[model samples]
Target chain A: MAPVGFRSVEVALQAGGPRRTKASCHTLMEPGMFIYTETPEIQKLRKNIVELVLTDHPLDCLTCEVNGNCELQDTAARVGIRKVRYPDGENHLDREKDLSHPYPHFRPVEMHPVLPLCAGLR
Target chain B: MGTPLRVVVDEMGGGFREPVKALHIGGPLGGLVPMSKIDDLSIDFESFASNGFLLGHASILSVPERFPLVKYLEHLFAFTAHESCGKCFPCRIGSVRGKELLQKAQSENYQIDRELWNDLLETLEKGSLCALGGGIPLPVKNAMQYFSEELKPYFSRG
Candidate 1:
């Protein structure tokens, strides 16, 4: 029988092409294309990215932080999104800084536990 | 039963053996699944979930809109309405309210306070029929709970 599976991370990454998945699900992706095999050098890069994103600056950069724990940095350190280019300005949202809440009523960022998706209003 | 709901379950013959049948089995999202493959005439739930090709909830949701946000409730609920059974007032009404509240959330409309959206939720939850009316609140409620920062501007003290 043909092996059937849930949509693989690799297949989704390929089908989405880039511009589609990049906007929302950046974290859920697997970065096997970035690093084919796990090596010592690759592991070190993964570690550094995790410490910076998850440990050192968990609440800081990246949009994924808002929905509680990030899947990207988690997987990055685990699988390796550490394929760094010196010229990595291909970052999607450059003008993200300008957008901000205007008034006195805005809430400051607060940390919280990640909640599971609702189990269908039951 | 008028017509049996087709359910497909795949079995791994390596030791674990369980046989299940479905008078009316459905996919994870309450959508009707096509039961194309049946080995011995009985539909299997475990097989469908385990080995069956995963259906695309996120992909289907993500298709109409560029992004899922406070803004896309209309698109989202459009999907729901077609999917809705139209049996109860709550589902029929709740889905309509979902579009409105989502729009309100997106535009920062009204005061974004308890009175406006809360009343809508209360009505839908208590009054709707079947699962559709009841289930309509999940996405809208999620946006309110999770995306409050985006909604801060709309809240009103008065």
Candidate 2:
């Protein structure tokens, strides 16, 4: 139940620690803590972020290459996202896909599993 | 008190009880049971939840026959939205969305995506982080289950 979103809220431990933290979620977490309460507020805030991001996102979940593997989709599912209320608000229709980015790309791995170990080290 | 009296009866347990079309026990998170089951209920958590009702604060709300369950649901959703902590996604956004959805049903000649709304409710119920988000669906489901005939008029195709 460690706050899900915040990674940057850092607590300097006397020992080793995680490299970087997502602040919103990390602020509520401690270095040595393995389990934290995922408060209702955190769930709501995270869900709101996803909803806001999805406003401009394309509605092509079915045809998209990422499809089931997409992080957004996964987050949405975790938050039980069923319907996007902002269908007419904004869309990604104008953004063209660019493949120019190189490999070894930045990926955000969920810190839940490793967080305890990192905190334990601290 | 053990005798099941109809809602129309004015006397109960030596107290004058007002006639109500429906009774809402356990506040907004609670279910609206038909008047027939009012006397049959026990003030216990297991019994209340087993009946799809909340064993919440034990607040009782009575609605007259003329009031619409859909309208009550809209107000309940709005109330929950205002009371939300502005945290977790499902409760924060879903409360507002739920209120809006119920409001949309109020307009004349509207087409509602019933399945979509149901799915939205399911998400909010399962995904929300707290009771505020998880409990909002109770009354709506109660209305759907017990009073669909009354709510049907609000959902006609545009």
Candidate 3:
């Protein structure tokens, strides 16, 4: 549950409380509990959330590396976010990528082969 | 906890020497109550929540008349952005976007789209993983409700 609003399972277990916990996609439906996943309100929330994320994210999906394979792109499409409603403002899309470590170097170069052999022996 | 707000401010803390506009009770994620309502409110969770406010942490911060409410709202958003643990998307991205929106409104006299602003608030309130992102909208909404006149310039005409 990535965006579960409930603090814990105990909180969710409480029923008819003054402040009822907002259920996430992964919240299990129990007996006597009614969960509406596809209500109009939920649909609107889904779209709005996608739009909010898009407001800060770069909109250069067409030119981006993970254009088709991106989860965000898929969610945006699913939610039918036609436009990002927020006005133009500051964003981190244009920030320079930190390229200090171009390639990762492994330590103990000679031990690499021996380690694999040791693992195989085990 | 049932102590009157006036008792807390005037009696215990020694009343403000200067004119104050509002009281930001409960900390950064708390409710912002205008002076007019201060007399009716009490230092209790139910009292605050009944009026669309929060009694979080029970801390009080006085807002002076000279301090712009819009700037205060911007600071709340900025604080949210700074403190977010980046464990979730809505808090991490939404906080930064909200701060940016307020910055543009303050600097360029921009009028943010009303529908979009509500949408952002709803997302933060409902989609965040924890209270850090969820509770921030409480004070911002309070400002929109109680200090509407001051925030009028920043909202679109529609």
Q: Which candidate has the highest TM-score of all?
A: 3
- Once fitted onto the true fold, the runs of candidate 1 whose alpha carbons sit more than 4 angstroms away are A1-122, B1-68, B104-109, B155-158
Clashes of each: 8, 25, 0
Over A12-99, each residue of candidate 2 has an lDDT whose tens digit, in order, gives 3323554321234434545564432355544554555466446546667898777877766777788767876543422335744533
DockQ of each: 0.01, 0.08, 0.27
Find the 10 residues in a row with the least total lDDT in model 1 chain B: B56-65
| Distance from true location, Cα of A16 in model 2, Å | 35
Q: Encode model 2's per-residue lDDT on B1-158: one tens digit a residue.
A: 22233332344444334556677777888777777676666766776777778757766678777787788888988888799774445566567767776677687455456765675676567555577878888878888778878877765432
TM-score against native, each model:
0.31, 0.58, 0.79
Correct interface contacts retained, every candidate: 0.00, 0.03, 0.49
Per-residue CA lDDT of candidate 1, range A1-122, in tens?
Answer: 12221111111234334421111111244553231223443344333323222221223434543343544434554655443211111122322222233322111121111101111111
State the fnat of candidate 2 relative to the true structure.
0.03
Per-residue lDDT of model 1, residues B38-139, tens digit only: 332233344434533223231111112123344544655656656765433334434554565556556554444555456445444433434455545544
What lDDT does the true structure give each of the candidates? 0.35, 0.60, 0.73
Considering summed lDDT, which 10 consecutive residues are worst modelled in model 2 chain A? A103-112
